[model samples]
Target: MAEEGISPSRQGRPSMTSSMRSSSFLREHQQYRPPSKPENHYGIDTVVEDLQATSIAPPRQISPFNGIPSPENPPVIVESGVSHELSHPNCTPVPGTTSFDRLVATLFYKSTSPRVSNAIPSPIRIPSPPKRAKSPTPHTESEIPPNMSPSSSLDTFPLEPPTTEPEPLDHLYGSYISPMCITSFLHLMSTFPLPPGSTDLNSAHRCLKLDTAHGHHPLVVELTMAPAPSLDYLSLSDLRKHELIYRFEREWNVDVVLRSDTLWRRYPRLVVFDMDSTLITQEVIDLLAATINDPPDLAARVSDITHRAMLGELEFDSAFRERVKLLTGLPGSIFNELRPVLDVTNGVRPLLRALKRLGVKTAVLSGGFLPLTSWLAGELGLDYAHANEVVIDEATGRLTGEVKGRIVGKERKRELLLEIAKKEGVSLDQVVAVGDGANDLLMMEAAGLGVAWNAKPRVQMEAGARLNGDSLLDLLYLFGFGDEEIRTLTR
Candidate 1:
């Protein structure tokens, strides 16, 4: 007897074949028959056709460096007798525009097409990973799976920038500081007000290298905090923040510029400068006064007025007129002598050169005479030059004690800055003003980044940032330029 659903030959050993028949065999050979049409069937031909139709990608070439092909040495692709190179290592011959390369490239590069801001995530409600109580265990090469490639593992688990659901009043602070100072700095910062739900102070901040330059490339320390509810009733109450920045500067001997971690200030489109005392060591007007020592007391008197005007103690227009009147009989040829003698402030040339290389428009707005301003413009390759023009007697070729055009006073300097920014199609927020006098306050206030360059106490207190470094080239650091970049630009 045979078991149900089992043939007599398969009853004994499961490996027994139909050809090895028992004694009860009905015939030596059995007839062959194919399955009915209703049964499911699979064949080698069907598998090959399905694979061709789907256009399945072949295994990607594993790059020796970081498992991703370098742009310089991309994988070569052959199509229609022409060998084309694909920069994306993961790209394949997909049928439509929905290739992996097309989708991933958008993630890395900016698009010129108009953006739909409505689709963007809320700035304050970004998602972040849960905080870890301890440092993560170090990962070793042996921990990687044997069959998994490096790129595949990266694709499976990608590193992402931190996202947090911070309050609307949360503030961000960025500073260039040395590694040794960070611990002490953070210790001091711990006293600052923190946002609600805050845990560890150490976890609320991060440090990163903003540049790869050798020799004293400061790491950028970013601290995020939200003022206590009692202090956050109004948005513009930043007295404490400014106080902290000032204290930090005085203690560290380095400026800690406060700004959003955004791209706007990093790349300014225009930089306007004050000629006297800012771009140059001496006031051109004072230099002009010294040239005429007929009275011997003339230089001292003029210097007194200039100092008063720069300190905001006197009106610029009156002070300028008083100084120019003393130079009534000075010969026009004096400009020729002073042109070569005028000392440009240290780092002015390199700073201007770097700005020019970056395609930033450079200008000189001077309260001095137009002749000297024009000469400096040509020497330093400034894009625009504006100054008060001292009228010269046509017959005698001497100063006539009269200004020919609109005085480039405080108001006019600001107006000129806007006019130039408009002409160049740059936003006011993309402009930087550098000056040292009270007259420069209006223009500096109007610009996005107002730097008081070795200015008086009044100007330093009111300006956006104060720079007291020995060289004006230190100004580059405010724009996030590292030593390597400064060297390259100056070179």
Candidate 2:
């Protein structure tokens, strides 16, 4: 009799159908031979250029995921752009958006690897292996399941930002380090007084560990002859749980991030800023629309579109096109005139300076215009900027009302965040994205931490953090900075 899982056809001697199936599988695989010989098939010139990029680069700090590259697996090379499959699996690499390092494991593996010469890229080329813990069915050449595609089973999963949640104490303490501002923490400590042995915050920059505060259990003072405590706390674990973490957030009026110390500090290696109403006081497009006052009706029409777009009522790209079309007759001089009055939000200058001091990388990713994003980067001391280009009619010296490049919309913002983080050699979780609009949400959610700064209600509710304060400098407080540190820096 056939076993429960075994088919009757395969239970005894191999059936005729089984032999036919094997023959068919062999026939299918025989056709999948290398498309071309390794000597000259693929773009060796691009490969040579990529090799040159790594050869010149200095040895980089190894990633936390895989300290060293795996000998067997290599970075995938999809020279031809990729269309994300319907699944959009972690292994799939989105052209222009997929981080080089993030695509490494998925891109290059023996089973589905592209035939490349021995000269492989480095640093960006090391993917340890697929990091998923779940054991799925093994991949076979004969049958390419969508989920097991080379794009889906990359050796390593795309690293996601680590989240804080209820977990064991040992694991939490392992990643526990600093960044909870000393001033606020100390203030809480004075009232709460830490358990006998845990963390000491007497130092300025980092917290020193006095003791791990382990190897003890407790009985309430009411049951035992032990002395009573002020806050009615028993064990050190309780202190971290109920007081330092939970109550501290409420009393201090700040969200305490409970993530890996290394990842958290590393992050914000790239801090992406949204342009309109975020990095700038005014939407440049809206400002441009207001530039044409002679045709009052056109200006009002454009302004209405701009207002609706900013309010998340209208689509940004279409609104942008319509607004630019209104300015078609306006001379390019209007942009220059508007540039001087273009205020980089009231407190952004100092905030940018403070970030520089912290060694955090900053980027201005605007859906506005490349002209403005680039100019703002210069004034704000930002490291990078990205946005759509505004094509001008050289003959007319006026707006063309058309973008020369791809529109920097919601998906593009998210992609830029990933690209910037990968280029900066940091994980997405180690980055911070701040924005105030609907377009900003995609990028915001992509970062290690998302901060909503006086944003739309939908955004505020979804962002990881929110700042409803007077100055952008208050952002320092989110990193745990106290009043004293903020004043000294500003002064």
Candidate 3:
């Protein structure tokens, strides 16, 4: 055994037969130690095979800064995604570390691949978004009150009993209805409640929309009895009853109006409106008050009086006298300076366009000064204008306390409407009147259809129809013009 331990032929080597036996016995007695490396070094090829056999996830590209996946020691991921390896040839293992331990740490602790997060996929189609209306629907049908009682939110007009269906358009009017019937209005044939003699649809006459602010659709008053009348015309009295819509609208802050198809609509030859706060957005008196010395206080006082006067609490004639008296010292040229600043109501231009399209005679009857009214009429292409005349002192060239001629108050306004209607060869029922004051009430009532444009509560209550906003073109809705018709008229 001694000779076998050392080479038998080597003379320099010591014999270690006894030592060899002793070391062997000691190795057999010691506890087991694991290998420093795993039996298989699973690099890219080994990992790819294991991955294919396992879950088969795609290879993840790890950045260099993160541990274990540096430039020299790249991450090992198989295409089939069965397994992975962390150990690299360039990496030196720490004490007690093995391939299995390194693999466990790398697989569990490594950050997600940049390729997965940064990749852009193929484009896919997405549905288009729904379009929205230019103006939101003011209300839904559900919001419209079913009851049309005088006190309810919805006002109703009692329809006369349906009369016998009349003869054809050729038989009634004795001629073909004008081409306007094609482009001027909405449904005038069946829905409109025509008076006794009307056989054909007059598009321009009865074309109107009720206040749409409450809803997208024109205003609809619940009929007292179903099926609106075809025989009777909607008169000033009938128009007044319909004010329940406008009156209750105050509760909702809705701005809209409804014009009835009536005698006035059939023969509408005259369109009359107030000057201040009706045709124009501003009240001439209020604007004039601002022109006075210490205008703030004067404007407040004048506005209060104007408010009271508009409410019918004070006579418009006296109120006009009192209000204008404050303008005694203001230069008459102030009106000219202020004239350019005046803005026509939004509905004014549109309504005027509609009126001109219909060839209706238009007039302005104002309690305000005549220069502004006359200028407005001229600018707006109105045929006539009537207002209180302002007297200028020749020596001082300032406004005098006295107004010339008759003060164009409520009674005068009514007279003017009648006068215009007469000159147009039409009856009082042919006149369409619009205003925003107490003075406008009498004349508004006298006209076939009286419209209150942003008037006082009393005026709104009394007028046939009330528009509760700054837009004047909506008045054409009262004439039954649809959106397309209005657009065409304006164009």
- lDDT string for model 1 (173-272, tens) is 2223554445545565566554456544532444322334444344444443333222353122253235654554444444454443346757999999
Poorest stretch of ten by lDDT in candidate 1:
101-110
Cα lDDT for residue 66, candidate 3: 40
Location of the lowest summed lDDT over 10 successive residues in candidate 2: 101-110
Candidate 2: Cα lDDT at 163: 32
TM-score of each: 0.59, 0.48, 0.52
Candidate 1, residue 232: lDDT:
51
Instruction: Please list the residue runs of candidate 1 whose C-alpha ends up more than 4 Å from where it truly belongs after superposition.
Output: 1-180, 194-241
lDDT of 3 by residue, 164-228 (tens): 22222222221222222222112322344644654543222222333344333223211111123
Better of 1 and 2 by lDDT: 1
After TM-score superposition, the amount by which residue 200's alpha carbon in candidate 1 deviates from its true location, in angstroms, is 6.3
Higher-TM-score candidate of 2 and 3:
3
Q: Candidate 2's residue-wise lDDT over 1-491, tens digit each?
A: 44755765567875466445654666656856564446565465655555556744466533233322244323333446864323213456667774211000000001111122222223232333467754476433233222323555665443542233332221222212223333445454445443355344232232211113432211000001011122345432234344445434333233333222332633256678898888877778767777667777776787678767766788877777777777777676776677788876778988888788778899988888787678778877899989887777899888777777778888888988898888879878678899988788888778877888878776765676666645676566545454457566666
Q: What is the lDDT of residue 252 in candidate 3?
A: 24
Question: How far does residue 487 in candidate 3 sit from its true spot (Å)?
Answer: 1.5
State the displacement of the C-alpha of residue 363, model 3, in Å, after optimal TM-score superposition.
Answer: 0.3
